[model samples]
Target: MTNPYKSYLSIGEKLDKSKFILATFHLQSENQPPARNASASDAGGFDQTAGGVAAESSVGTWTDVSLQEKILWENLRGRVVELDEKASIIRIAYPLELFEPGNIPQFLSSIAGNVFGLSEVSALRLMDIELPEVYVRSFPGPFLGIDGIRKITGISDRPFLGSIIKPKLGLSAQEHIAASMEVYDSGIDLVKDDENLTSQTFNNFYTRVDEGTKRMKEAGYLKEGRQKIYAYNITASYEEMLKRAEYVVDRGGNCLMMDVLTAGFASVCGIRNRNFGKIIHAHRAMHAAFTRSKQYGISMLVIAKLARLAGVDSLHTGLLPAVFTRDTCLTW
Candidate 1:
């Protein structure tokens, strides 16, 4: 019997020099019927009607290929790189030229598009992406990386100490100021609002910023030559988010916190592009909903890379003895 994946292997080999996307998918037996007539050589052929094979015209038969079929076979088709029957894992390679530069929405739609809804797969997960240099260089990376962060905070030695205000919400503006005062007095180099704490009736965002900074100055924390960073959560509507960021900066607050996942990457880019001159602390709240499932959705590593590209000064990697599982924590 001929190898069913011959076409896929050939396509992959031909595109070896070009940029391509590497995606790992987990296949479940219940979703995919066993292949019957298909051999190893023909297995990689896209033929949805054929058991376990993706439906499409063969790349080898160019004469019979239609315009759509030709475009798909040549530019959009996913070439099988590896298949493990025992583990039910399949790795596919897709040419990178198919994707638009610096656009995550379009990039994801192409790489992780309709493949998931295939009745042949019970669950699908994008485990990793080997982005090419050209693609990686297309996006603007972190504006304030580790060195820049250290320069602003003036901590040359050891890891900088930071904390999140506990009891995430329901604190009034005065209460927030009092809490911040205690935290600063305790010598924590940085303090931030919880991801869920934004402009609310109980604690208005502007009031918190005004009160927090005023107390920080009056307590002599700013005069003592110690620059205590306060990252007020600015997660809100697109307009409100930017407004909150501006308010913080106007009030002498040097840092702004954003629930990056909830606020969306585009909003982050907007803030960064505005040249606000305030540090951006990225909060990964609500990330686990999609990221936690191993058999479906994107991974946190991919999210982190995207966040860095969006220009966050710092991001939450995870904390010890916390909610995240051991494996999940390690992955971050």
Candidate 2:
């Protein structure tokens, strides 16, 4: 038999002491097949498939269990420990009630037999049920979330209006900042540097931030506290980004923005974990490579969860009721 998550069980009980371990699960089994002659050095190796060791076998299948909501079985840290057992191939236990109720079934179906336990059909009919962390774990959402954003900007009811300073390919720093000013003064809620505006020879980031943020601030005062602007600090490196962020704050900029996709996951996570005193606006630029294919690409829902975990205060989720239309606003 296989122990997919034994060590995680002991770690789970002591997770409070170390935030590093997201979640853990304990799998018990009975009348299980004996462990094959696998080498200890091959514990985490990937070549086990070519070593001729037989994989997990299933006994039964799922039938017709149905549920209204989707189910999710998350492994917060994405690691599992194992435990020895006695008839069942393996019995897994996880935290109950923390999932979104939208991805559970698919998850159960995936781990069936050969890996964790349940058989194929049995996995399919698992129904929508919440599991305990002993089985899985989810990460922390934005330190300052959507509600925090509204509070920070002092806006409520409708969505926070936003736009990007564009023509990123051709605009000079002055032109870009000037365009930003137009959006700021128009009483729009937010303005951002399109992802491409990062320290291009045509537009130095320092010069643009100095000019754009200054104008936006003036416009904010004239709006009688109605609208606000956020300048993106998508500079070259982490330190540079942080430096630009500080500069923006020093100039009294209210919010900050970034193209999370362009910067990479760790960058987003680092920015989110900081105490920047501003709403972290995340742009999903370059997301198509991972989300364009329905079957092959990752689900937007999953990306959203990871973004939240990485600390994005707000994100650009295509326009409301305008995803597949012709007009810009009609099909964003």
Candidate 3:
């Protein structure tokens, strides 16, 4: 019996890595039809699914298309170069011409998009993307990198010390300010709003910026050489966000926090594009809904990379493990 999709598979072939964008996926495929030998390892089923993924993600469909009648597959298509059925992993490479330059959404759409919804594969996870240097250099990098942040915050001796304000929400504008002062006294250098916090009636954005900035300014001499930094949450409609960011900058606020996952990558790049001069703090709220599953959805490393390209000064990865404490020694 001939496998109709066998032409799509290129396992163990030597090729140029630079000509294509490579991605690795964890795959589980459904075994279909007469090839079902329960005692045999389902190698045939997995191979078909791999070809389907490469084709669906690049330039093929359920059946052959007329486009192939006139166009050459060499110029555009995804090639499956490696597979490990035991590990449930397969690597696919899409020609660079298949993706748009300087467009992250388009890149993701082609690679991490429709292939997930395919019935041929029961489980699939995008593990990572290896992009070319030209593609990587297309987008703007960090606005305020580590050295820039150190220059602004005057904390070059060690990493900044900060804490997430307890009681994630429900704090009045006054209460938020009071909490900020309390943390400052304990030698905390940075304080940020909760991810869900926004312009609630009780804690309006204008009121918080007006009052909080004054309090932050008064506490400027928290130490002999360092000043306090409050990362006010500006996660909202993109229009409203710009206005709020402008207000923060107008009132001399030194930092702005945004929920990168919910607000989208455009907002991150938008903030940096405006060059508002405030530190961009990125929060990954609602990430576990997708990233927590190893057999589904996007990778956190990819998210971090996009945020870096979009210009985030700081990002909350996760809480420290219980192993470390105040008494812990350091060697940095």
Candidate 4:
């Protein structure tokens, strides 16, 4: 029988079906052949002719296919649009019906699952995605965007100045509070806990938020009507993360920070749904493992987009080289 994917040979045909995801895959030389077949099967590679009378009677024609089989095949398969041997890139059009609107976990599993483990692929990266308008509109993105952040921090003319607390782990709760107050007094607009700085033994999350905000108010920072944002790192288990965020909000904290990569995009989206009325600062703590390689893993740009879609107010983009290592720079 004719290849089912042959029906969607042109860009116009793919575009006509509005609900679909456009995914780009990078394939290494060792697995190119199988990767091609796997990608074809990933979306719709099932042999309609196998174990049936249609296999023997209409082996070379598409006419014998039933309407139900055609519809099912189309819904299950991803259409291959471009495959470049020299450059090693494969672009596939995944049906929008394959994903559920507003569900990131399911979306990830559909577009990003299992393909990496295929024996044919030595390395595979999900470089980019072209999400349809309906899918894009289904999620509530950053509530506080760049303009909103600028308005909240009262810094519109230039870049907002911020710093991470040094010696990331050992500081006591009081020490953390002192350092934050000093930064706020020094005219820094924001201060954030380092990505690894969670509820450590010495620097408890609640104590830091409680004393830190108190010190900010006492420093006359709030008295002058200028807001100084303290992004308390709330990266923990799903339940613990929510509790930490709630604690920050209850104590009048202005911002919440999370290691978006380690905590998972779903966690960030969950936090956004809480409507806590605080800025969400996203730290790409462990993104390098999946984003550093040029020929393997995803890109930081895609990660940033996902974070924004998950509703982060401010995302670390590696603008400051001094803050990130050489390896981290590669991911950015």
Any runs in candidate 4 off by more than 4 Å, and if so which?
1-14, 31-68, 223-225, 319-327, 330-332
* Candidate 3 clashing pairs, residues 3+ apart or interchain: none
Top-TM-score structure, candidate number: 3
Candidate 4 C-alpha error for residue 69, in Å = 2.6
| Candidate 1, 1-332: lDDT as tens digits | 44332444432254563477666655554534434565554443232212222222112321233455645665655566666656756666766766777776676666566655654456666666677778777776677678876776677888978887767788898987798788878878888898888888999988899898898778765542357888899999889988888888887888888999888888887888788877889988887876888877768887787787777888876777488775456444
> Please, what are the lDDT tens digits per residue for candidate 2 over residues 1-332?
33332222332233332222222212222233322442454343222211111122111112212431222213331222222222112222332332343243333233322343322111111111223343333433476677776766678788778887666567887888787667766767777777667787888877877776667656554243453756565645788888877877776666667777677657766665577767777777666654554323333554555565666778766565454322212201
Q: Predictions ranked by lDDT, top down?
A: 3, 4, 1, 2
lDDT of 1: 0.69
What TM-score does each of the candidates earn?
0.82, 0.57, 0.87, 0.83
> Is candidate 1 or 4 superior in TM-score?
4
lDDT of 3 by residue, 1-332 (tens): 34435567899878777777889899998565423232344336788888888988888776656658535775686888999989999999888888877676777789888999987878998877787787777767677787777877788989788887768778889898888889988988888888998899878888988888888778673233366788899999999999999999898888899999899887778878898866899888876665767778777776777777777888877654463331121101
- Clash total of candidate 3: 0
In model 3, which runs have C-alpha deviations exceeding 4 angstroms?
1-4, 32-44, 69-71, 221-225, 321-332
What value of lDDT does candidate 4 attain over all alpha carbons? 0.71
Give the TM-score comparing model 4 with the true structure, all chains together.
0.83
**Top lDDT model:** 3
